[model samples]
Target: MQHKYLPLIIAAALSAMSAGANASGYRFGSQSVSAQGTADSNAAEANDATTIFYNPAGMSRLDGMQISAGATMVVPHSTFTDSGSTRFTHTPTGGTAASDYVPSQVTAPSFYLSKKLNDKWTVGMGMFVPYGTKITYGNTWTGRYALSDVKLESVTLNPSASFKLNEQHAFGFGIDAEFMKANLGQAVDVPGSVMALAGTPNAAALAKQIAQLGGNPALLGTAKDAHGANDGKDWGWGFNLGYLYTLDQNTRFGLTYRSSISHQLRGSTVWDFSKVTTDPIVNGVLQAASHKANSAALVALRTPETLSANVFHQFDAKWAGMADVTFVRHNRLGDLDIQFPGTAEGAEVIRQQWKNTVRVSLGGNYVYNDNLTLRAGLAYDESPVKNAELTHPALPDSDRMQYSFGANWKLNARSSIDLAYSFLDFKDAQINYTNACNPLATACTGNGETTRGTFKTHLSLIGLAYNYKF
Candidate 1:
């Protein structure tokens, strides 16, 4: 029965592996093409239904039913160069010869709809991806023992309502239902230390068979180069609150807050020994041992909360300016703990020690004419990970600068098309990681290994959207 579903599982995993996110800390920013053009500073300038994401209270600003749909193409380029790496046995001493470690492109899509329930009320709904990540390294790379691939994907459904106290004040609240999944893969080395136990009681025959199968008898018990995979999925719930204040016809301010969410993911781990050796006798023994080590795991993950303030000012009908300040409580993600049920391995904890971060953006729009609007913006985003030691291959986050430009073309009084482009430059990052072997494991033991390298990344986003008012 499990074999029948193996292919489907693998396919789903691969699909998840191809998704990626934007902004710092795996948060995406292309939910609205209109906002993407202005470097995501549209919270207070709620001119469309997309405000359902940035500030739901802005929904009260819309006069009628509105629908907005868009997609963003995210193109990321990451390169890693080997500084120096050492395996447990100190046999391999450098990183992979291949330079590119991340995929070149991916896409994220979003949809939003808003309706004015009455003169003092508005309702809205939206679907989008808020957090995701994907990274793939050469399978035989020097760091393969530590990590080879990692994927994290999440989607959120939001339903919201806003109440207008008067012409100047509006309050909004919403519920978030989010689904997330994660997959990780790595290689396990077969070390000589394990092979040394060949003459021992339970290992004698297995060791002899491995030696006869062309495996170095000298490295009898070590991880003979097996593969390990972990995959899981979960659902979490949260809420958001927003307030909008219109100082006058020409100026307005918006504040929004999104609550944090916690997820307990259920998953399983599989260790494939067939990849380690080809001998039938040795394969049978190792396969059985690998299956014995397989166990179900429960992992806990938390997404951060965020607070944002936005300002919009209209100097004239032809010129308007906007600014935004956003703070993310990333410190909540202290660590990731995975517990194996019915296994003696107990649990494994990876410390994150992340810090709260802030992002600032400034933008302006120009009414080129009655039918065209041009937008430009600049932003600086901080990373939650403090340094290289805290950085993981799955999310190699860094402080970044963004420059964006966009345009909105009005096809008629009730329809328009939006286009935006953004360029992101991430500061170079350093990685220094080490994994120690477990002496209690009977399969392999040779101390551990260290991987040191430099990572460089940059990304470009192109977004397109169509908006309609009824």
Candidate 2:
């Protein structure tokens, strides 16, 4: 049974809450065409099983039974600069420096399915990622002190149903169960006097001081008690709603809305120092206390909501067009609070002035023969990261345009192979980061530098699906 479903798992390899714009907040766009044509319009015409990830109403158009399974390999190559003279330092010497940084390689995966119950109703289920991001800077990086590595992931399970009202209208709804997690750790390299006065007698004390300041184990190498922090596991649920309308024999329109979910992730967090220090006291005493205190500070996070509409038209037997537009509501994530187990310090609050965003797409399909088809599409996606607070490195998003090409090869009456390739071009942008002010010295804290650089990415997809009409 597992072997038979390996493809499904591979196809559903990735479904994060933070992918790009395709997943929930990620990118797992549907791969199905329209009823009257191939998928080439805005997000409105979710006409296939992939619609389980987009909107449920599209299920209403199915006849008896259908199933779809496929996979997507998402590859993104990114670079960053300490642009505004962003500060970073090399160990052993501990001097200020600057250099271009390259992030790690990322691969994302996905899966989907739908079924019809009767003439007036349809039911379906889909597992996909809608939110997740990660960035790992190489060794000898400049911003090593301020940041080094970040990882975030999110997934969703959707069960939906659609009802046909009359000949021209339909409605659909679904329940979303979501899970999310995040991991982060960075090094902070500042001058010695700044540290001496900051209350650390040596590297060991410095590690303790920083941990008290939410600093991770990236700073002091084998001397300080540097350790990583995990946001643990967060679980929550939301809902999806949509509508579809047929204008005539040749045209159809669709609209969908996905509600935002709030997660109060509850899990165990460990702050271990095996990598930070070899000294027993450093590891056994102060380090142990910090870990105990840190675990008590885990809390909640808010995901965003979105809305989209699509229009698809079958101009002729060989020619068809598709277009879609979508909007995201990010204002709901304005503030996040993590309470501490010790009232001596209280809770930590991170503020986010996230703004709404939009995406637009257009596409078309061509049938070359009875068993083969070709597809092409273009989309413009907006960035969700704000310039002011963009340095966490969990994400560095910017506006981009995607050009995609794909083809389908039918093997028999019930099976087919699908392949697609897409290239993303992004505009260059700058990031300026401000660290929390040092209570003792205000000079360097208030005086931070910026770095300038650029980024570009590409994606490849290969999927196989079995379809049986009964």
Cα lDDT, model 2, residue 263: 65
The runs of at least 3 residues in candidate 1 whose Cα sits more than 4 Å from the true structure, single-residue gaps closed, are 1-19, 89-95, 192-224, 284-292, 436-448
Q: Residue by residue across 1-470, what tens digits does model 1's lDDT show?
A: 01111111211211121135456676775688999999998789999989999999999999889999999888888777767776655556443554566667778889999999899999999998787667778577767666677766668999999999999999999999988777777665554334434457657766666677665533333346666777777788999999999999999999999998877777787767665554545655665543336777676666778899999999998999999999988787665555666665535434456788899999999999999999999999888777877665556667889899999999999999999999888888777765444323543221255667777888888999999999
Using Cα atoms with residue i matched to residue i, what is each candidate's TM-score against the true structure? Answer: 0.89, 0.77
lDDT of 2 by residue, 1-470 (tens): 00111111111212221223233223344433221122224344554576766667777877666666655454555455444334321113232342323222344445566778888999888776665555555323544434445455667888889998987998899999987665545442323223333334545565665566665544434343233344456668999998988788778888889987766655443445554444444444444333233443345555667788888787788766788888877556453454444334333333344557787788887778988877778877776556645423333456666677777677787666666666666655445443332212322121122333433333333333444444
| Backbone clash tally (model 1) | 10
Deviation from native of the Cα of residue 321 in model 1, angstroms? 0.8
Q: Model 1 — which ten-residue stretch has the worst lDDT?
A: 1-10
Residue pairs with clashing backbones, model 1: 189-223, 190-222, 190-223, 190-224, 191-222, 191-223, 192-219, 194-221, 195-220, 195-221
Q: Residue 167 lDDT in model 1?
A: 91
Worst 10 residues of 2 by lDDT: 1-10
Candidate 1, 408: how far from true, in Å? Answer: 0.6
